[model samples]
Target: MSDGTGAPVLLRTDGRAAHLVLNRPRALNALNHEMVLRLGEALTVWESDPAVETVVLTGAGERGLCAGGDIRVVHADARDGDGSASAAFWRDEYRLNARIARYPKPYVAVMDGIVMGGGVGVSAHGDVRIVTERSVIAMPETGIGFVPDVGGTHLLSRAPGELGTHLALTGARIGAADALLCGLADHYIPSAALPDLLADLAALPVADAVARHARPAPGGDLAAAREWIDACYRADTVEEIVRRLLDHGDPAAKEAAETLLAKSPTAVKATLAAMRRARALGSLEAVLDQEYRSSLAGLGTHDLVEGIRAQVVDKDRAPRWSPATLAEVTDADVERYFARLGARELGLAGETGEPGAPGAAD
Candidate 1:
């Protein structure tokens, strides 16, 4: 049931399976507040339905799974002097992410094409995550003056060595191989097989669906790459990450470093801090809570509106940040990013510790 706003993120149920298709192909199925609300409602219904045994999530059209959040909407809301709607939108969206992470039923994300930003949130947390040859997975949040939200910090932190920190700050796009290597995705099936696989999942029983999806090919070693990433991104500040990248001299590493330097400083700093803290937390709720605090504060402080203006609205590809350099970003600045909020704060009050939690690998 869509409101005819942006695009209808359709929810269909067949037998004991639910199929979620991101329908905004023109925009690469970018998520909006309405889509998030609809998805949450559908998930709520499916969660309690005894008839629904599994859920398969995919994007409509051939472009992608989802590009990210609807930046146009975000820009308009920011201009209206009230970012409350945007904040509330993230709160609900993060709750949805938490639910997906903890969902008991077999949840599979069919990442066929460009799966990025908010797309990562929707798909990465699934019980069985799938990727194809065409899958272009990334956490390119810093590029848009936003930290990787929607439980991305959780996934990023779990990547081998300092790769998480490198990716989080640089906003690098990884192909299917690198994505599998980083543990961002679990299974890899040929793109041509997706239709048959989807049909098989839809037709099978819960246990059978879980059994049918093929295992992922082994990802290459990231430890070798980590030495360079750690060395280049070693500085305590976002600026240092870039400087180290500049010093590395490797073409790929140099280009990646330059990319981070181009993004908003505050976003990079906030993301760095967010990923660091998320690494120490246990439950999904705890990470989401901390992220909520960071996101809420980001509405007024971070360069989201300006970033959107340059990237989406104007397409100028030039965003003028407030604190342009990482050195301009102070400890207090980063500290306030983690400050608590009243009334709408997420409840992460009593989480203790879980050693074998998802994001604690390195």
Candidate 2:
């Protein structure tokens, strides 16, 4: 479908750089199924085209690269229809995420604005992820009663120490430096220099073009809080983690505890589970398969519907999560999210059975 300017995703080639501009700026370039299909189709074509040396992804407006998936649609689907549409969207979207990770050519993501949820899926997996001072990246699904999907768990679970756990539970937004420290972004480019950088990409090799504009990232908050973050978030359970956070005597830690408490209880618990499982799942593809299970499971739950209504539809900012409190979210409740899906599986990992396989407001 058109986002007025063109397809939701606009594809073009300038010199050697193939560009995919996410066109839904009115919604901060929010991704829908049509955009996902367009992206996959473009990549498939570019992979075979001799002229396309690199794929560059950027969002249309100043707000950000992408706010996330077209979640308003997902909310409507869950509320008004059987979830097959949402499920199909995710199936293709996750495949596209994996494709970017494993893309034969260099894939550059211009993450200059708000990159969250599904936005992170598309960008962070790329060969080159460029973040600017304007970037605010997050994986905030827990707040809306959803588990992180599109390989988010794989990326977060692999982040140093307990930082990923902290991020997953709190649904926090991090800046460029924090993103780099967390292993989310590769290069830093000033937003002002982006126009010049794009011009260089058309003529120069990907690395050379990026190096011309990339600079050392400025420092950010996550580094200073690492000691407490590592110590408090190392717990085996979400309850224990919150207990540690509250008792740590650090105001930041206490605030984190409050944030965790405020999110959807079941989502928080299940997200914690997803992060931990993602670490042991061996490869990115395996973790994505696991995430598919978790995503579909969350799709069928009460909290998912209510959380969206409160956060998006009603704009209340107060989600009344089912099971209410973390204590009420039982082990079984969280485990249900990881249950297998058999024939409905994403099967990306299983396609080649190979290793070396490849979120924020995310």
Candidate 3:
């Protein structure tokens, strides 16, 4: 199976399995627009192919499975209001994520290293999620003034109690065992054995590949800290949550609270609302659509610009958030984010090769 651009998916077929190795190690295989399109195309082909019984997705290096989207470009586009360009990236990326969720063929991801943000988007939704001791999974979007997109709400909401909300708001990192506990991974194997597993996957039949790659017993107890997480994050607003964390008298909880408070207040509130709504009412597609709306509209807002400026553009870590307190964020503000845009739609993609061509109009 060749990538449409001839860059190659590094595709190799054994008896009944195929392997898709993400090749751009330089940037940790971050999802550029082209890579996103290629992945969607590759998966579409494999889904229809009779001989392909299962597929394995992995990254190129020790750095990570992926570091998320190519945010440098996204930042540029955001500043320029490059909707025509950026919209294609998000639409196709979201479609690929949704496809992964619904894919029939058994899919596996070798989460060998750092798996954060968009990295979680691509692999976490697979049929068989594998993690190694090297795995470092996180949804680190709030730190950047962005909501966790890539169907993050679907997985995060399903996590124990408010841990999902805590992680989304705080952008905390979870190790392999903790990720497994959160239902993000199905197996745990030693990172040293990934090569052997890959070799087995590349040479053996689909069933044999799965058999050879069978993981060791899952490790550690991630649920031990669940009581603390739920307690610290249960408060209604960011300020309240911070106060609760401080009162808990746990050093880690206090540190997390301070870090979260330093982030954009509006982003924190909007993300919490998104997660809450995601739990009760929407499918992943609907969630991503809502996220896209927030992201699109957020670019012009104060937090996003300040966030990018403080975190990425300028080395200084101070961000001046508008309505800087959670108390300042109202239900009306949150609801306005979800309210229908007058005559506006995210205009999706179509099967045509021309990427910008919009899908059926809303």
- The superposed Cα distance between candidate 2 and the true structure at residue 190, in angstroms, equals 0.4
Q: For residues 57-156, what per-residue lDDT tens digits would candidate 2 score against the true structure? A: 9999789999999888999888898999999999999989988999999999999989999999999999999999999999999989999998899999
CA lDDT, every model vs. true structure: 0.79, 0.90, 0.75
Tens-place lDDT digits, model 3, residues 139-185? 97777777788889779998888878888898888888888878888
Best by lDDT: 2
Candidate 1 Cα misplacement greater than 4 A, ranges: 1-7, 205-224, 348-362
The Cα error of candidate 2 at residue 268, in Å, is 0.6
| Candidate 2 clashes between residue pairs 3 or more apart in a chain or in different chains | 64-114, 116-360, 116-361, 116-362, 117-362, 138-359, 138-360, 138-361, 139-359, 139-360
Worst lDDT window (10 residues) for model 3?
A: 348-357
Clashing pairs in 1: none
Tell me the deviation in Å of residue 262 in model 1.
0.5
Candidate topping TM-score? 2
RMSD of each: 3.9, 3.5, 5.0
Clashes found in each candidate (C-alpha, N, C closer than 3 A)? 0, 10, 0
What TM-score would every model get versus the actual structure?
0.90, 0.97, 0.87
Better of 1 and 3 by TM-score: 1
